[model samples]
Target: MSQTSTAFRGVERLVAGQQTADGAGVRLTRVLTQNLQRRLDPFLMLDAFRNENPDDYIGGFPDHPHRGFETITYMLAGRMRHHDSAGNQGLLGPGGMQWMVAGSGLIHSELPEQESGLMEGFQLWLNLPAADKMMAPNYRDVPSAAIPEYTSASGVHVRVIAGESHGTVGAVQRPVTEPLYLDIHLLAGSRFEQAIPAGHNAFAYVYRGRAEIAGTAVDDRQMAILANDGAAGVVIEAPVDSRLILVAGHPLDEPIAQYGPFVMNTAEQIEQTLRDYRDGKFEAAVVQAL
Candidate 1:
């Protein structure tokens, strides 16, 4: 075979699964997320949780302020009602996603309805480039059915969420970090492979079941970071009954200084972010600062 596959050097396996609280102490899993510090380049965090009892996730994310970033919430099951100061509101069901760009600033709240049942989902954070960090606030609420998926002949399933990879492309169009977000599942006794562009950093997060990634055995609740291949495309392997989240993006290769919901390149920027929020220097529309 010709040299066409991107081979990542070194896989930094993050620590085992951890948990954190949101929206009044509602608990959630910090799985394959929070690589924002070092490993995952431009992406900030990923939180996954499953709630059956009301107490598990009842008190949803209350009115919170955000700036210089975007939040993408994907629901696996149950309903999530959303209301934002940007005048955007909707209900996110299983397979639904709420993609909000908190440029400049915005306040939003997400609360689950009265229905009682299993509610599972993921919330991801992506940073805006320095030039676009202070842009206008916007949102993209993608319903479950609106998002497209492509299944391979080998039973490898790929859902395009924000970017494009393999032969599948997500619907949302923006100046992304040239990334590909895919949710994949491999059937029993199956082997799957997908190609990734060269020079992009790639990682695999095993969400459910066990699978072999990059020739390394990664079971549930673990993440494998692959080294950049520069110009050669990369491929991933998935064993039977394995579910994986494959994400690859061009590294910003820039300095990152983060504080709560604001991420900038310098300490002065972080301080200015707080000042703007407190003094109404950045508030647009009737946005709340909670």
Candidate 2:
């Protein structure tokens, strides 16, 4: 097969997240939220939690309700014990990821497995279109061993979680918005590029080291939201060894209304979700999956 060069998607802006506490005092960095920036369409929020102190992260996230979107939890270090209204329970450890489809609604809890050593992870919220908002809830949890990894000749490594790269496809399938999620690492002087869908929104969040994104320098814990006015790819060159997460997805282009953990396309839907949740829709929602 002929190789296509990844094009230049201009950098739209550079931004950084802030420290915030959510869900029973679990501290995290809130990078993207509905109120923080303009509509990112298919995506809603991205939270990065990295803590070594027991007091900082021991609280964990207690039972919470969600609807109208999907929640993706990826662990880079430590362990998170998960239990939900749907009878799903498991231990999400280092390198594992859980994708929760909160179409309609579900209640779940995530707690630290131990007092603490270090807990590092990311939780991404992807919006669902009006059509799929009321669909049945589900989940897809992939272990580290099941995820696909690729290493280049120049020492650029990638973990493909929900897209295709280097002829290898990720384990996630049937996404409504057709998203691309990758954890990338680059050695100093190494360059990496990847194709993106035309007209789709794309962004890169650098959490470690520094890199030049589309000719713009981005430091750790910062983000570069690409403009759709340019080419259809993201290009990166690491002046120093770096690690980052790259995400892009087709926009739903629909109205969005969010309240706490509940997200919907309309305030009426949000109200309905609240009513259903309060009325016990997810009260007995445990469905075992092995």
Candidate 3:
């Protein structure tokens, strides 16, 4: 187990979310900043999506390009297969994850593997610093069976996706951002506590049931940004069986220029990315896994 910091941030504010459609009409709730306020900084955006109606999700996300950031997809139900510009392809099932570094640029598509009985997942965007923005693109895909899990005496199951939890390190091959991403499930009336990086900005998204974070009742699909006040970690109370995703990352603290699928340091850089995509750089890059 990672040592808990002496002081940790508590729930500061609740961020309301809205639904938005992107990538060939994949409808999802958009969380985090909608404008360029950059309130979330290194953690750009989080999308919480769940649909049982086949028509609601069967379309999936089609080919899309990304740059100057990383995209992480965690599946809780159903299956998705991805194909990228570099000829890399893989399938993600329940409890699986895919972390893609669209460093310079990359093109990819996530499509449902079947007609779809139920589909639920999240796609998180974590920004890269200006220094690492234009690096080479890479992909890391981890299956459900491969992720590290820990069960507590209270029946809280924690999936360490990209951080240390319960004495187990996450499976995510995260390097640049070195962020912590954890999926936590708490049984009814269970409690959860985990250490977080002292220097990183952190937030938690309650997806199911209710989480009493810092004594505030956070409902489903709600997010709480942890206060920056020095504190070791967060303590959560699950009145009912609840699920949440915790994310924390180092802030790039750089000027952000975002245009559709591109996030760069400046408008000129965004234009450059467009030019590169128009010039077919992502597709032409040599195929390899990171």
Superior candidate under TM-score, 1 versus 2: 2
- CA lDDT of each candidate? 0.73, 0.84, 0.83
Which lDDT value does model 2 have at 215?
Answer: 88
Candidate 3 residue lDDT tens string, 199-287 = 66888999899898878888999999887666768888899889999887766688989998798989999888888999988777553
| TM-score of model number 2 | 0.95
RMSD of each: 3.4, 1.8, 1.8
lDDT for position 247 in model 1: 73
Which ten-residue region of model 1 has the weakest summed lDDT? 281-290
lDDT of candidate 2 over 1-290, digit per residue (tens): 21255467888888788789988788889888666424466889999988899788998999888888888899999999988897788889999999888877889999999885989989999888889888778887788999999898778999998877777787685466888899999999999888887787888889899989878999999978888874777789999999999988888888888888888878888888778888998776654332
Report the error of model 1 at residue 103, Å: 1.1
Model 1: per-residue Cα lDDT over 144-179, one tens digit each: 888889887777787888576565668564575766
Q: Residue 273 of candidate 1: its Cα lDDT?
A: 84
Q: Tell me the number of clashing residue pairs for each predicted model.
A: 3, 6, 7
Model 1 stretches with alpha carbons more than 4 Å out: 1-10, 32-36, 229-234, 281-283, 286-290
Candidate 3 error regions (>4 Å) = 1-8
